[model samples]
Target: MTVSALTRPGERDRLIVKLAELDWVFILALCLIAGAGGLMLFSIAGSSWTPWAINHVSRFLICLLMLIGLAMIDVRVWFALAYPIYGVGLLLLVAVELVGDTRLGAQRWLSIGGFSFQPSEIMKLGIVLALARLYHGVSAEKARLSWWLLVPALMIFLPVLLVAHQPDLGTAMLILMTGAAIVVLAGLSWKIIGAAVAAFLAIVPPFVMFVMHDYQRQRVLTFLDPESDPSGSGYHILQSMIALGSGGLLGKGYGLGSQSQLNFLPEKQTDFIFATLAEEFGFVGCVSVLILYAAVIFMALRTAYLSHSHFGRLAAAGTTATFTLYVLINGAMVMGLAPVVGVPMPMLSYGGTVMLTVMIGFGLVQSVRVHRYAEVTSGKGSFV
Candidate 1:
């Protein structure tokens, strides 16, 4: 159907029209990536779907349904709930700091009634929605260089500090970058951007040397030189590099990757799964998966660009930024180009939390596309 057809009175509000408006192509790309992940998990498990493969596929199916359901909701609803969602995520982060569980030496997860989740995951979406809502009201001139920028800055840093205090630096970085992406998209000044970049550069050395935990510092050091400790702190990166290199041009024909099958590669089902793919499928397979990722990114950014409302644009763009960061950080870490910050390749990695979080973000992106023509009220008034 054409755009003119949907402009008819009460036409766009129908469920059938909304469903038709959904981005089926975008969904197909996601399915391809998730399917590849399941294949690799099956391969690594000796061709059994018992452990990693089944769970990965099942969780993805559930999340895909959730994404479709969320897509049906009007973007105005998302705009209305933005602040409340952000406020709740902030409180949960505070709660995690006080009474959260410490897993693997990090105080990141909160358990309630035998259920546990990382509140930082909520902040991933919260920060995007919240910042988008804030910028939707501000004038471009004010957003560029005025002192009023501090408000958005505070909105961002508050969660960053809290999540960083949890010492889940990976999630914290993701949240920080996502928020920054929205601010830049909203027209922040180049001078300010340059200064902030310089400031970050100035602060990194001290932050690594003094603020980062011992293991965190060591990961950075290891990335700089993985061969220094092949059997210790650097083992994960070294093994990942070996797996990536041994895959050659066409790979070892699947399930025959010595690095992963022999248990040389670490975190095979989670953060290092990309290396597992590299080892079994080779460079060709890796590039194929990456093309799927590139398609998803392109479509998502196009949705943001096509949005009529500022909220829709920023929210969709911010979510895309988060997804892009996940792929880049995990890919770089697997290639030994960056520290192992425990960021998994979204949808492809074997973790429920990150998968759910990513799916939810895409849901919002789809919501934007479905309601791209809907008029969002100015932030000074009610959302409707």
Candidate 2:
């Protein structure tokens, strides 16, 4: 083979160069996190890939492709599709109400062509995009306590209510926080922010007393005192705490975590997966993993800060907030610091839908990076 022939470019070579514009650091960080997930899954499967490991890796690879494809598209396309995507997400939420699948006494899952789908996951992104799109055109001056705020408030609350209706409080809280952050970023005044905070604090008591279901109320009570029950509403937390504490500084080694290996840990592959990691890998492993997540959030926030376009800024920041909240909430739950709300440990937790949504968000973040110069203004006329 001639060197000239090897160096020559065709469509495929050109495409490769184009895709290389992507931020490789962020991509590598994601791969490392996913690799940790696969390893953890393997450990959970008794040092095998037959069950969770291979599936997690395969899903991650598939989602990585989706990420690249999304990155390659014009972010303006994302901006333009924001509201439409939000609308579709809303419809899916409605579909869940009509014919949705139920698991664990919660009507949150949806079935589509033999695939388990969750519309609330989609709304996580859709709401961010919609808020970004909504505030994209409006001047910051008009966003603060104006009648214009009503539309964005509705955009947020509607999905939040729908998700809450699914009884998926974790996801609902995620959506609500994402919307609130975007509005704040859009420059909602501090006075309004303070009042909103006060209002939320004011509502918590009544909401917990009157709004929460029996089990949900039990969870809050258990969070307050897990030792009180030890084996009922508090079983998961107590067991998780024991496993975490037993891991000590260096952990029990892979596939040797007594809690999981001895069948003492609950939800080893899902919500409490972090506890499993802490059990096997110990505090050092957990901290190392957290540093990685911190780096990811830092990069994401930096992307948002640097993007000239308001849409890119809001979407990127909101997505980062979602990821951060997921990690924080799940970590706290496993460590007995917060209520167990079924929030997974991001890539470390096994879930096809959440993985896809996270990767897609990073893909959009990469788009912001690559097309940093490709600015789009706020308004319908700016849509491409």
Candidate 3:
């Protein structure tokens, strides 16, 4: 064997030391947020772990392990797999169209044996990875041109069209917005961006009327005036707003929110989990969770800024943007400021897949944090 082969174990040992140097503050903040979710889920379940709390805790532990494992792997490994992962994610979405589970009136889940998952969720990370790789090889001059822009435009558009076909507009919008963010971060010109935004605005009303499914159109209408159908199509927004406002300053106390404990709030365990927390713990608790989320984003953006590679920078920043959208969309949805979009509040929501996807993204952020000084180039990563 060559000398490099003989010394591979030493290189592995150095990576382990780097793992020990991972940012604990970020990890601890993550745990606190997850812990807060458990408490709220407990309340949402009428103070029983039988339904939600225990599972939330368990899934968080598993995802935490996954996070650390991914963090230990060299960024080059992620770099090499980026496009393939994106390709696989695309295939999974296509497969969903073929034989996906139809649940809650949306065909977004794919079932395998006993396990079911959402491919759109995977695309959230896949888009970030793929676009990061694309832009890593791009120059600012190329990024500025219209023809060269087709590369990223198609990368962002294709999955978006598929996900929207699933009629999962929530996740579709997420992918679209996050992908655009990566394109912007890739050094797109303001002239191009402005024209694009104008084009989107110009087409939105017609698109909503013609292109949106009936339920999708209804959601927009409901957002504009939830009272229009308070007992029917607007029930979720109405109940969530009631729960949110009733909490007052100090809240009704845990397990005692009338809207939730009485079973008026829809999907409280998942999409409306933030409202569950707010109803039980009031304004103070909501602010606390937001602060935790802000800290995570701040650290992630900081990690991106310190990264030596463009992939690391864009990947971290894109992941951060997706997460920020999760918070904004969910927070607004529950407050009746926007349409109900079924976005979970990171670890705070009781869905296993969403939690797993978020942790996987963080694992990449942690990779950037641990190896921020490490440099990699197009088509190759430095071994040491």
Candidate 4:
């Protein structure tokens, strides 16, 4: 069918048309990355599907179905519910603060009906959707330089402060970067961006020395000099570096990585899974996985570019930014280039919450592609 036919009144609304519009290539990329993750998990778990391997594969399948279901929903429904979703996420964050579970010394999880989850995960998507919705009705000039920017600023910081108080600095930083990306995409002035960067640089030292919790501050110090205490606070980074360096050009061979098999690499199935891949499959495997990630990012951004509605564009782009940050931060941490922030490699790491969050973001991206031609109104009564 031609572009004109796809845009006709009832044509795009057809379920078959929407499914056909879905980016199968992008979907294939996601499947490949998740499969690589499952492969790594299986290898690291003594080739058994009983532990992390099966759960990782099963979760991806479930999240993939959820992604497709969410993709079929109208983008306008997403726009209308944006604020409500964000509102609920914020309230949950507050609830977490008041009576959240304190596991591993972080009060970031909330339990309901015997199921526990980190509310911060919800904010990951909430902030993106809410900010995109806010920017949708505003003009470029106002978005660039105006007193009107305060609304978006508040929308971002309120959650950042709340999450930071939970002491989950990794997620707080992700939320902050994702929100900043949307603001810049919305045309915030360069002058403001530059000033903000300068201020952040100035604030970091003081924040580390005074504001950061002791463990958080120690992670930064350890990243700088992992050799200082190889078996102490720096064990995670030092062991990760060893795994990466030992991997060499090819690898030690599957199920033969000493670092992970000996239980030397910390969080081998979660945060440092990349290092496990590096050890077992070496540089070649790592590069192949990185290529897959790059493809996903490129295709997602292309969807944003193809979107006609401002909400669709910003929503897709903002979600892509969050995913990109996850990959970069996790990659750096694994290689000992950045502080260990516990940011998991999306889809590649065996974590249910992060995997679910990332796939849902992609679902939004696919929805944008499927409804790229649908008209979305601004503000009240917005619809297709």
42-107: candidate 1 lDDT, tens digit per residue: 999999997999999999999999999999988999999999999999999999988999987889
Residue 329 alpha-carbon offset, candidate 2, angstroms = 0.9
What digit string (tens of lDDT, one per residue) describes model 3 on residues 165-250? 98889899999999999999888899999999999999999998999999889999989988899899999999998899988888
lDDT of the structure predicted as candidate 3: 0.89
Error of 3 at 233 (Å): 0.9
- Candidate 4 per-residue lDDT, tens place, 257-309, comes to 99999999999999999999999889998999999999999999999999999
**Candidate structures ordered by lDDT, highest first:** 4, 1, 3, 2
Q: Which residue pairs collide, candidate 2?
A: none
TM-score of each: 0.96, 0.94, 0.95, 0.96
Among all windows of ten consecutive residues in candidate 4, which has the lowest summed lDDT? 375-384
lDDT of 3 at 289: 88
Backbone clash pairs for candidate 1 read none
The candidate, 1 or 3, that scores higher on TM-score is 1
Lowest lDDT block of 10, candidate 3? 375-384
Candidate 3 clashes between residue pairs 3 or more apart in a chain or in different chains: none
Off-target runs (Cα >4 Å) in candidate 1 are 1-13, 380-384
lDDT by residue for model 2 (71-180), tens? 87777888988989999999999999999998988999888789888899899999988988888888868888787788988999999998998899999998999889
Name the top lDDT candidate. 4
lDDT at 254, model 4: 93
